[model samples]
Target: MENNRAALILAADNSPLQVGPGPDQSSPAADEVVIKVAAVAINPSEWKMKEFSYIPLKYPHVLGSDVAGTVVKVGEEVKRFKAGDRVIGHCLGLVYGGAKHGGFQNFTTLREAVTAPIPDAASFQDAVVLPLGISTAAAGLFDDLKLQLPSANVNDDKPRDEAVLVWGAASSMGSIAVQLAVAAGYSVITTASAKNQDYARALTGGKHIAAFDYQSPSVVGDIVDHIRSAKGVKLVGAYDCVGFESSTRACAEVLHELNGGGVLPSVLVPPEASSLPAGIKAHIVNAAAPGMVAGSPGAAVWREYVPRALANGSLRMRPEPEIVGTGLDRIEEALNLHKAGVSAKKLVVLL
Candidate 1:
């Protein structure tokens, strides 16, 4: 029997999204595969875009970024993946030059470039949580900042001791950034709420991580003091997972304190810092804009780095997501929870 189920759709105004069953599944394109989505992860962009309408949202647009599912069908030209392959990928959502549909449905279609086989060890819930954040973190730390990976030869005498601070370490992207940074041989100092401190340390392989409550007024000073006290804190860099004004400003202050004589990389737009300390640079992480397919750089990164990392175990699945509801009917509640703020955990809806 044909699968007919409701999908969460965004109206033209980008207002509250609605869940409704609209159409039957469409055949895959030559380079596409049809996936029976098992889980979908929410991202801040889903709500942020509502205000800007930056991406063209055709009426009834689907808004979701991360997905893990089984491939039920594939088009003639789809080679890297086949039917029955379990996979996870960034949905790219319909608004941002993405596929015709997104992951927030019982089924969605994706091109070969953005899809990758999920690890045998990962569950659908955990697998879905990694792609979007891990991909961005990899792109930011490795590609944008041009940081080198550690060599196998221990005596190679490379500067593997330099530290990189990950602001907002408990966030999904922040959490992944810690792991990727540690794997690359940089000591990681991250900030998270007091409750998530211990969990943050385990995720990053237990390095020089420190958790600070963003709610505390002294958070900025705490980060700066931590970096300054570290031995040989030269050539420092940072990744700001939270892009709010305060988070960016706090990171900026710490970077200024470090004064490592190089640019500090940020995943979000950096705050304007006049009178910045000497030898500090700030670059916004446009992870999706590089090596993009048909002028989409984000897609290119997803295609290139995501697969190898998964295959090599350089990236691992996050905590298993709590799957809330199945199909489109559950979207409104999910969005409401996202708007209200997640409690240091990811909320996913199965489709």
Candidate 2:
């Protein structure tokens, strides 16, 4: 636990991420593992958190969520992983708040519940794309949207005739949401830019997934009509991965168009309450809300489902990471690019 380094934000809001020596690594506590971070991915939340200071921080915060690395140490109570295990995990610096838990650092402490072993064939760069994207999508599709749990074995498959709307299917979170919903046996109708239609279609997991250009003027009507007219299928719910006002409202409108009411649409960002349609329930999904509890839905994902799915190839690192550069020094630039907006791609930095 010496000489480890990290990228730190010295001040709360109005600051840049700085590369420098970080605190010495600490011995893992029960239920925790320490990792030598091999790769990290940038998410919009990190930049927003740095700018807005929305989530509580203890000044000099470290902000990152997605991480892929090799295990350096494991705690006394840990049984699932050991030293030298290759893993992908969701670091909790954004929620837990510190450099030790942050992904920007050379060494990070990961809760066993939120960490999973990566397949030998997958690279850290590709695996790093899964942590946050998978967590957010799983939280929405499996918990909030209440879709059927995904299965790796085709023999145990159950068929369903419901359709799900994945607005912003080109975004990292949306791409995974589409895959998860399709794996759960629902027909997926999703929106992306005209350019990303092929990318979205590729992730449909051999299930029925329809891609529409969200920028088209008739997107709403087109989605509504498609879902409404699809033979023998009912619109069960939607997941608005881009939770901006327009996307959120579009989800509600589609649900309302399909059925008068009683449909749920889970969103990443909380949409304005005033803009939500009456009787159509829209809820904000906090991917980290499952909070390390043993029996929680988040636990099931990180502990059980993610590991099996990753091994079986049922879950994938989607939209692919566009390597920004190497080293912690490149994180700020990568994050700025992410904040500026990217389509059908995730920004990644190898450490």
Candidate 3:
């Protein structure tokens, strides 16, 4: 890659993300495509990567996961994309290749499986919200939970007898999981504050079993009771999107009480197993997990479903994007703002 600039750290010492020349990149792998990044959404991990040296990155590293941009180069084996196509990619820079693969730069490389074309009607900022959220949720539902995959066609059209509980449905990852579960024909049970209950339900197109108030002390019982009240619906599993100890406990408790014990996939690292209820299993969802295999649930979502879903309005841009500023220079400010805490909005930097 040439003529690329990036918001990267000089050292992983709680350093600022400074704009500078990008790391040099060699030719892309056969399954990879190069993107001219136009917009990127920040994640908690991005800030933590510096503040805590959470990942122990190489010096002058770049950290980004959510990306939306135009294709500039394609590998010979890449069949779905070419130069000039608009797309969104789940860049694995911090987790995979150090600086070269990061999305903070104007140019980033993405594997075909984790990349998808965005409809022309959609803006980069709007589409940028999908990558990490979609990847993390897909890893939880389709990979970890091994739930059925979503579709743009008639696949899994019949509703199943099982239901899934999504804790903190108003959050970014939870919202995506809610829609994906409902789209896969499993009724979703979710939790949000009283004010956002309707918003969470709306994420499922009103197909969710219920959106309980998470602030209520009885939320766990409420979710369990609601799931039990459904005539034939079984509580198959739960995803703690918030991943806090309390929410994790709530989900595991629901699973143990309702399903007698089940697997729980969480967006954050779960509490220690010793502290959890007996028979409850927990999995930490890695956004990069889905790209590990061919024809994976993530593959189906990004390659087979998302494009058509976005085009037809079946999928929505949830926890809508709030533009932090234009250009890579603002990524530090965006990361700091995100670290301080943002509710119901994904911070974005446009280039």
All candidates: CA RMSD (Å): 4.0, 1.9, 1.6
Which pairs of residues have clashing backbones in candidate 1?
288-297, 288-298, 289-297, 289-298, 290-297, 292-296, 292-297
Task: Tell me how far candidate 3 lies from the true structure as C-alpha RMSD in angstroms.
Answer: 1.6
Q: CA lDDT of 188 in candidate 1?
A: 76
C-alpha lDDT of all candidate models, in order: 0.67, 0.82, 0.85
lDDT of 1 by residue, 31-118 (tens): 7777888888877776666556766766666677788889988888877887789998666554343434566777777666667787
Off by over 4 Å in 1: 1-10, 21-31, 75-77, 94-99, 149-159, 208-218, 260-267, 272-284, 290-314
Model 2: per-residue Cα lDDT over 223-305, one tens digit each: 98887687788988888898788888888888777787554545455566666777677777877854444455656767777
Instruction: Give the per-residue lDDT of model 3 (tens digit) for 222-319.
Output: 88888878899998779999989999999999999987888889888899988989998887887787666666778788888888888888888888
Maximum-TM-score candidate: 3
| Top-down TM-score ranking | 3, 2, 1
List residue ranges in candidate 2 displaced over 4 A. Answer: 155-158, 262-268, 290-294
Give each model a TM-score: 0.82, 0.94, 0.96
Alpha carbon lDDT at 242, candidate 2: 88
- How high a TM-score does candidate 3 get? 0.96
